[model samples]
Target: GKVIEGTLSVHAKGFGFVLVKKGTDIFIPLEHMLNAMDGDYVSVEIVKKVPKKNPEGRIVKILTLQNKEIIGVFKSSKEGGSVIPSDERYNNPIIIPKDSLSSPKIGRKPKNGEFVVIMRTGWNENDHTVTGKIIDILGKPESKEMDLLLVARNNDLTIPFPTQVNKALTGLPEFDLQKELKSREDFRSVPCFTIDPESAKDFDDAISLVQLDNGRFELGVHIADVSHYVREGSAIDKEAYERGTSVYFVNNVIPMLPERLSNDLCSLKPNTDRLAFSVIMEIDSRGIVQKYRIRETVIRSAVRFTYEEVEAIIKGKKHSHAKTIHLMQMLSLILRRSREEMGSIDFDISEAAISLDEQGVPYSIRPRERIESNRLVEEFMLVANRIVASHIAKKSTKRNPKPFVYRVHEKPDKESIQSFLDLLERLGLKYQLDKEVKSDDYRKILDIIENLDYKYFIEKVALRSMTKAYYSTKNEGHFGLAFDAYTHFTSPIRRYPDLVVHRLLKYYASKEKDKKGAMKGEAATLSKKLDSICTHCSEREIRATQAEREFIKIKSMEFLSSKVGETYGGIISGMASFGMFVELSHYVIEGLVHVSELKDDHYDFDKEEFTLTGRKTGKVYRMGDSVTIKIKSVSKEEKRADFLLV
Candidate 1:
């Protein structure tokens, strides 16, 4: 009935869809796209309406261009040069003028088959091409440098801090130890320590534990005070908001802030005094929070312990903080039990750790182990987040809650849950679904299958049935954590939402004298802005996750490239009419076994049972069935591997 505004998501085939904030996507055919490229904000008028299928639309106007630069492979010919975009959404190649290549600004001409970053100058609709100039050369394809650059450019991740941002950082006040101690709660004498990976350089969180005289424990979760350094609306703050979150690739990181801030000023380095937004909770021996306080504080970390070291300490190995470590272990277990009793679902999925050589090529791939030390830190962070969120939620009524960002995990849809139950029934597993199935029901099913051979497959299916968590201005509660209120309040150095939480908390705290008056005007402004911020942060988080997964996949394929013809045992992780995916044992890599590779007999796919059965021979290949397979081939560019049944 009227022109609607939304972000245009262009497909590789020239067609696209306009994703509205509160409605279903409007499908725009190729001809009706009105020259709108991928990631363009556009207004569209509905041309056709359908009940079940997507509504058709025609682009009315281009509001803005979201993607201004592209990373692609440069192909030069005698006729001219063009760049084939690495991002599939931008199907058309960008035409580059020969003279522009040799320009003084460009420095040198890009060679054929080289990867390059191109800044869009203009678009030629009639010619169906985009015009751009070579901004940077990103080495050869499949190389580590090129792969990382491609991921960064495709995700719109800014690699370098702007001059203005750097200048703003330089103008920031140096850490005045005396002034900070006077202004903030002095926790410098506390026995605080950081636990992180051995390779980590930026430590954003620290923990401290003390036995209280009242027979309770004082558990402190201190987060790096990033918001203190990054002033709101400043160049640095604006840049950080746009980035939304730091992206961690397998071998590199694209930080939201400058290295000066993230790695030095805001890092909780051992033996150094640092500012922190701390959550101090007085929790009983039973893991119940009796009281808590959120405060700006100064802390000096007594030591830095890696997860490996903590694990050893927990295993009774002698260490300097052995007593504190034992107490932490005890508290974490109590808290974990408390959560489990409340129906928190723990999806204990292992991730792949790809070891790279000096050249950035993967030398090995192994499943990363999750130990008790990891859980000890995680449980504390979760509790700290919950404590802060509950404080905010309680301070403001449900009808008029404060403007805050929450990490929300919604309940699974009924249809997905039913499908999961059906699958379980077919697999001969016992699971009685109630009218309203809580997370505890799922946990029960998981516990039953914990020792089964098909446990991983079942867990994957259950996970797929669940919805993804995202940042939202509305507190819908975190179903996964079994918390009625929760928000990310830690790791400001890496996560932007955590930084935003710190800023909002500080803003609210500053208006304690006129809380009601401040909530009426300033809170309204914040509420309006939070919607967009939450949406942007959620989208960026998804993009970062995708990029990380793609990086891992690329490296996994590379690791298998040299192992062609090698045999390994694998479980059938997935099945389709065309092929089946097999996940190798002891490795996190999955390879496809095409249906055509089953040469012995004609196969029939049973979708209901998720199996491929041989018609004459009566042999079947089912999900979770272990089989021997030989690596057939590897495609590094496609991030794929082929396997043949042995």
Candidate 2:
């Protein structure tokens, strides 16, 4: 058996995969997992290799343990029963000792089928049992609010500030508007405004654009100065660091900061003297940044416009800021053109906007409408973040680069890119593959498929083949954005990395005047803390994204459950040996139509072409092929759907 080390990704069905660096991920069956938890670093031993399928592996050792909160259903007996985990990824049942039968929250024995949380004390290798005690009993989810509570507990997200955080909040001052305005650059008179979603409450960033006398444009991107209020090492800052970023659900949000600061104090509210860290850039007519300055400023936002309102304004509704909006749109177009020319890969995919009723039942699902107004704001923020990152990276050497958190996306691996190219060739679309893949290669293919009927199918594959973006202290350069350096600096109210970057920028700016202070081992002290911070923030970000995606899938399944047996138009979005996934028209909901359900004849799967064809009937199913389907079954708990081919 050949041994290899990689992170384990467990599926809900108990099977798992270990993704090594060089090839397709190795598979591990349910019995071979060795009780390894999802997301655990493990050593896997390859036991069998099957052509056209991933190699099968057995877990040889658990390299690292994940201290995760446990939630499960309790089954009690005299000798200490067991708990069945709500998450199906846990292959083994957890044992609850007789003394652990009594719940701490209720101070009573947990009845069968009651949802309870457990704290794992240790694993009993002698008995091969995972031992734990019941910590809290979450009563059965009888209502939508209780369901929300269950979701929050599973994800470790909570509302209202902690006691220590609130205590630190009291120490913050009620800034004197007069005194604050005198200490920094004043942008109160500028026509600055915020554009965000209609449901947005915490306005973090605002923009001010002016046509300079020398014919260059002055663009001011002002972000909320959260660091000014929440000092480093404070309780509030520590809590924010733990959160990493805000988690937005279908009906609620777990904010990174308390509402007092997120929505009121640090928010760039209109007609208020708000503290801001501004990035002022001077750009020529061709969208080239001529010069820039970073400064702490006091800004009074003039208007807060929603994306819909801005779109309406752009379509000729009369308003005082209409001219500014139009100019910003013109500049955004130029910026986008320049970015595309620089080989920045833009994946133009439509995000699903799911709407729920009062009872948290999803009733409507559609693509989020993207307009010129959205792009205008996005372009400004991207430029500001890029400039902030480039300023530090360009000035320092590779060995002594400033210690900062960067939003980096590394280049795609050759194996994944080769698979994608093979798929393209199978579909009869050919292109020359360079020795090394660049962002521009992806950009060119996406442009070619922009108007093709199979655009969605191909684009999804290309995106899946790319590397995930994460936070890192090293500036490896962002492959997707085609930038020499990049960092997030636009939304400190929602993101912790942005706040840390703001503080670093200010600290370095001050030290520029004091050579001795700048040489005071500041880099060494900061560098020691950065790697862990970046890793934690990246992990939190992935967790938040997973939670958000889970909620959407659950809601989507619930919606589909209502339509069981109802026929709808669908397209084959994905294919596997056993089944094909069909996505409904005008909806992002996908359901698996198993090969067994193909009634006419026995089907054979083409692994390379991803085609399922009948032996006798000659019926073929492939990616991007249209077909009618009916919902056969759906499981909201498992977040899965099955469909019948019609």
User: Considering every candidate listed, which one attains the maximal lDDT?
Assistant: 1
lDDT of 2 at 279: 97
Candidate 2 Cα lDDT to native: 0.86
Single out the weakest 10-residue window by summed lDDT for candidate 2.
513-522
Write model 2 residue lDDT over 347-367, tens digit each, in one string. 777677888888877789887
The TM-scores of all predictions, comma-separated, are 0.88, 0.87
Candidate 1: which stretches are off by over 4 Å? 1-70, 81-104, 118-135, 142-144, 398-400, 513-518
Count of backbone clashes for each model? 0, 0
Collision pairs in model 1: none
Worst 10 residues of 1 by lDDT: 513-522
Residue-wise C-alpha lDDT for candidate 1, range 1-646, written one tens digit per residue: 5789999988765799999998899999988876667788889999999889999999877677665777888999675698887765666677887765655666788888988888766655465355778888877775658777777776667788889998888787768888878779999998999999888989999999999999899999999999889888889988988888888877688888888998899999999889999999999977899999899999999999999999999999998889999999999999999999999998877689888887888888898888999999999999999998888888886455588998899999999898898888878986877788788888889999999898888999999999999999888998878899999889788888898999989977887745555346666788889988899999989988988888888789888999999999989999999889999977879999999999999999988889999999999888988999999999876678999999
